[model samples]
Target chain A: MEVYHLYSGGKDSSLAAYILRKIGYEVKLVTINFGVLDSWKYAKETAEILGFPHEVVFLDREILEKAADMCIKDGHPTNAIQFIHEKALEEVAKLEGVERISDGTRRDDRVPLLDQRKTRSLEDRFNVQYIRPLLGLGYKTIRELTERLFIVEVKESEKLEKSDYEVELRHLLRERGIDPLTIFPKKHLQSRVIGWKKEKAHL
Target chain B: MEVYHLYSGGKDSSLAAYILRKIGYEVKLVTINFGVLDSWKYAKETAEILGFPHEVVFLDREILEKAADMCIKDGHPTNAIQFIHEKALEEVAKLEGVERISDGTRRDDRVPLLDQRKTRSLEDRFNVQYIRPLLGLGYKTIRELTERLFIVEVKESEKLEKSDYEVELRHLLRERGIDPLTIFPKKHLQSRVIGWKKEKAHL
Candidate 1:
């Protein structure tokens, strides 16, 4: 079976894709482009580094604007990001031949996490299975696994360029003269996979 | 890193150990023996067939008796089984050098499932990480994966010889002149891993 995994150029999603492949699924890395910025290209490049087939799926720019507006009105990005995340999943789940969809949501993730009800609804409506490979793993284990499994670059969220809703949302916020730093929390770290370690140590 | 997985010779736990090994953890299969029966031997044989090292961890027989009483009082095995599952996790979490522990819990499991708060509490109290690789997967995906991944034997729960707590619990109930059939629901199916599929087709 083939599973389409929502890809960001980040450690969590990359690790998720890795696990799915190990579990006998042919994994396709998908980067959603909402047209606010070309962040999907970053994800595509990272996917190339990881050696998985990759593609960009374009969503309406209107959703990005709406999510940004919600952020401005609510003074936070939690609900808005979650909104876009669900929209992204729905879009991918509807594709022909896409019977299994996945994301990198983790046990410790607060924002952009799909509740069980919504997950079941998505699966039932689309006749698909939504797999979150990292859902059972918390932050500490994820850190250890990624550190051992890949070479990564970590920096503040805004400075690090990865394919996630935040990049486009931040761009839209900047376009509206709203500083994203004020909306997003301070000192938030983001990571991008650079390459795998040379040792093949796990073998 | 080494992770001790709570194994029962069932497909779910076997698949969990497979995924953990793929993620670079040396997996040790631990079968809980509650002294009601020698069911751990079944799990040991399954682990050998899968080529993983296995061990039997003895838990207090008193706990099993208490859980059996809970079942008789509640007229159902749900609460009692959950009680024993948590105790088993606690006992395994205290073993030497066990920094990570895992189980075969799935997203749809109701009874004997650990909630987020309790999972966090276990991690904090024991200073260990709890990993449930199958927790993100539902019934359909698990069935698909297991069917393709292993050679399995299926039978009614009462007739199956897996190493789950139900076997010993049922034995104890019958010893007291109670028909375990009255306590456990009817037509419940159980599975045991007999061996791997030939051809190593996935490779």
Candidate 2:
């Protein structure tokens, strides 16, 4: 069975591919790179290091323009680009009866969807299998797996550029104590007030 | 130092608390039970077994119902309910001054934000440290740890309701010989095209 992993060449995706390969499956790596970034910064390089066939789906100006339009028209969140990647996955899923397109998203991410929401019914439509090898995994094991495999470490080249949103947000929310996961748009606050003061506070 | 673990009562979460206690931290267990789901199915039972203070935040009918409505109205696939759970964590973050909110979401869950879709900023806003003890850990190790602690086995649980849409779609799509994660509500196909088509195909 041929499986395509949504590769990103980072600790998570790299570890995910390692585990899938170890489980005795012919795996191919695929990464949807945004034009602004190195696109294949980590994903392609790692796929090369692992000696696996890799595909890079470049997000051209048209793709970015459409994304910006979606965000503006639908009031999509600033990070709604995942939906685009999901769309790219569909293009890949149509490969010669390819049955499954896998990803590295693990159980530990605990991240919310773009627009501060979660994808509900997007899956049934795609008509492909999204396998997350690390769904039930923990961070500690992934680190150990990386260490064991001697997969290329998170080198300067593999890391996200300073402009990468993941890197930017990680710094803001994680290091700066912003807690983006809990913060929401104006509308979210007007509704259910969790621990907020009735009027003065914004979520 | 005060720390809170997002407990789902799953073995992974159970081990998180167990490991933390072993290391000796004043740990508080917070369980989020979306009202739409069987909130305390295995989680509550698991928490009872371990003797940890379990605080469950239910997504009131108002919350999830409204979220489902927004999804339909906007033609966007989203789960606002999960955001509420994140919001609840912020409350916990504030109440306990918990510098960190650790979860069972592992390393593969690197897609903390939608690739190009949206962003979750709550984790940053609250200054709450979000830690995934298992981020580097694997499922096999998790199973081993559960057994080592004499916790309930995975085999005992007949059904585990998931929180992520991609995983749920994976199951449904796999059942129908497709990959759900691919069509992750990308603009290529509207909900009518994907959701109804899959539903029709299923029947």
Computed on C-alpha atoms, the DockQ of candidate 1 is 0.82
lDDT for each residue of candidate 1 in B1-203, tens digit (9 for 90 to 100) = 99999999999999888889877889999999887799999999999888889999999999989989999999999999999999999999999889999999889889778988999999999999999998889789998988888999999999998899999999999999999988999889999999888555323
Count clashing residue pairs per candidate. 0, 65
Chain A vs. true chain A, TM-score per model, equals 0.96, 0.60
State the lDDT at A80 in candidate 1. 97
lDDT per residue for candidate 1 within A54-166, as digits (tens), equals 99999999999999999999999998999999999999999999999999999999977888899899999999999998888988899999988888999999899788899
N/CA/C clash count, model 1: 0
TM-score to true structure, per model: 0.97, 0.37
- Candidate with maximal DockQ: 1
- TM-score leader: 1
TM-score of chain B of each: 0.97, 0.57
- Docking level of model 2: incorrect
